[model samples]
Target: MNLTVVGLGLIGGSLAKDLRSKGIAKHIIGVDKNPDHCNKAKELGIIDEFQPLDKAVANADLVIVSVPVNATLKVLTMVLDLIDDKTVVMDVGSTKSEICKVVENHPRRKNYVANHPIAGTEYSGPVAAIEGLYDKKTTIICDQDKSDPKAVLLIKVLHEAIGMHVIHMEAEEHDRHIAYVSHLSHVISYVLGKTVLEIEKDETNIFELAGSGFASTARLAKSNPDMWTPIFMQNKKSLLKAVDEYQKNLQEFRDLIAGDDEKALYNEIGRINDIRRVLEGLALKRAQGN
Candidate 1:
């Protein structure tokens, strides 16, 4: 298969590397607006060749787009002009509702599969991509029923081959769930990092006092702001709702601490602990393939 990965950033580069490593695609090509990214992707062996968008899509059996949320619709519009009925186009953007709505009425919408693989790190660029990055990850396929059956099946098979478990979801539902889980986490991390930097202006010595808890919580702050800014904007309504809820929870905890309500604080912490238990159970289930 001739596969073309557009953007050549973290997700796109990772996909190209995995597809090539697994021998799933005979020829893997890459497309990127940034010449540096193209050169780096080629050097990293992520793709066999780098070409212009038109030529890449024209010759591709599968086209995987991994760009920012705001850029997704535009890229899809351009790809649609070049792709044929047999070509399978998939996008790995964080936000899906807007993109899905934009392409809903397009004549060749069946060739497009909207996918969000729940995997990534606080990094970007082709150099940051690693093999097996998508392995054991849960990939959400939004509005699969709206896509062509063969195209959807091919995408599912590809994701499975790359060690991802597929889950079907409506675009709106995916946005809502990810807002709380993924988007809200990034918001909190960014704010926390800002707060800490304000207090400890000395970046060199701040790490001496920072423990594992702080390190873990602030890890997402290192993520690419360019990518996240558009995602937060695209899902503004859902993200705002999530932030409001988080603020309310934080205020409640503050009030408990102020009043020295030991029992209430303990109970609240215990309830959250239950969430950890639930997550641990889910992890175990996934490991056992249950």
Candidate 2:
């Protein structure tokens, strides 16, 4: 396969490395606005070479877009514009509803596949990318019916080739569900980190007393804002609703504590413990996947 990856950051760089390692792509080309990133990608041997966006995608068999969600809207259109009819395109953007809508009426709409690889770390850039990032990770294919069957199958095969579990869902539904699980968790981590940092400015003992639980929960705060800000903005409609729901739950817990309602708090906490079962199920799946 001749593949072109548009953004040479963690996701794009990782994909390039993995495809090459897996022998899925015979020649891999990269495109990025950052020459430094391109240079780093070459130094790391993540991509064969870097080319201009138009030239890189011109004769490729497939183009994998891994830019930020906001940039994805424009980049995807631009990629579709450059590719020939046989080329298949996929974007690994976080949000999908708006992205799917942007090219809904394009002549090459059927050539594009809307996908989100549910994987990453609180890091960015080519230097942070690693092979096997997608191993056992879940990748969602949204609006599968809209894409050409061949394109959809090709994307599915590619994901499977890279050791990803595939799922299909409507783009809007994918956005709504992801807002609660992925976006809301990032917001919580960012806020939790912010809250502690604000307090730490006055009381430096905060980190000294912090434990692993805090570290784990706040880890996503270290994620690149350039990538996440666009995600939060593009998915604002669904994210806002998720935030409101989270706030309601937070207020309930606060009220319970303030009211000295120990019994109610105990019951509420116990009820929420059911999430442990769900988590355990995910753990079992991960173990089995390995």
Candidate 3:
């Protein structure tokens, strides 16, 4: 397949690397607003060449829009408009509802698929593009029925080629579930980092006092704000609800701690501990490459 990647950042560059390495995509044409990223990706062999968006998508068998959520709205539309009937396109935006809704009535709507691959790290740029990032990860293809069957099949083949498990879902449902599991966690991480930074002015003290637990919890705080800010805004409604619930739980825990209700606090901890089993199962599944 002749693939065109709209953004040569982590997601797009990673996808290009895996697909090219696995022989799924014959050639990759990169398109990015950043010339430096495009050059870096080509230097790293993530993409074969770079081109303007119009020229890139024109000859592509498939185009992957892996830009930020806010930019994806415009890029995806441009890709669809430029591509021929046979050229399929997919977007890797985290929030799906807004993206899917905006292009629902487009003339080439059937040529596009909405995807959110449950993979990534607190990094960006082409240098961060590594092979096997999608290995054993879950990718949700939202509103599959709305897209052409051929396009959907091609997208499934592309993701599955990179060792990802594909599942179908509605766009709205994907956003709601992702808000709690993904978005809320990011909010917590960023805030946790901010809290620590504010309270612990001494960098040496933080480095000495912090353990692995703190490091892991605050890892996502290093993620690119350019990407995450748009995601938070796109799913604002669902994220607000998730944040509200999280605040309520935190309040309950604080009240119990303040009131010296040891039994209630212990019970709450015990109940939350049950998540360990679920997390273990998930970890096992990923380890086994399910």
Write model 3 residue lDDT over 1-290, tens digit each, in one string.
89999998899888998998899899999999999998898899888899999898888998999999999999888888888898999999999999998899999999999999999989999999889999999999999999999889989988888999999999999999999999999999999999999878755476677899999999999999999999999999999999999999999999999999999999999999999999999999999988
Answer with 1 or 2, whichever has the higher TM-score.
2
Model 2, span 1-290: residue lDDT tens? 99999999999888888889899998989899999998999899988899999999987999999999989999999988887799999999999999999999989999999999999999999999999999988999999999999999999999889998999999999999999999999999999999999999999777889899999999999998999999999899999999999999999999999999999999999999999999998888876774
Model 3: lowest-lDDT 10 consecutive positions: 200-209
Which pairs clash in the backbone of model 3?
none
**Candidates' lDDT values, in order?**
0.91, 0.93, 0.93
TM values, all candidates: 0.97, 0.98, 0.98
TM-score of 1: 0.97
Error of 1 at 285 (Å): 3.1
- Look at candidate 2 and give me any clashing residue pairs: none
Count of backbone collisions within predicted model 2:
0
* C-alpha lDDT of residue 136 in model 3: 98
Against the true structure, what is every candidate's RMSD? 1.3, 1.0, 1.1
lDDT of 2: 0.93
Where does the lowest 10-residue lDDT sum fall in candidate 2?
281-290
State the lDDT at 117 in candidate 2: 94
After superposing candidate 2 on the true structure, give the runs of residues whose Cα lies further than 4 Å from its correct spot: none
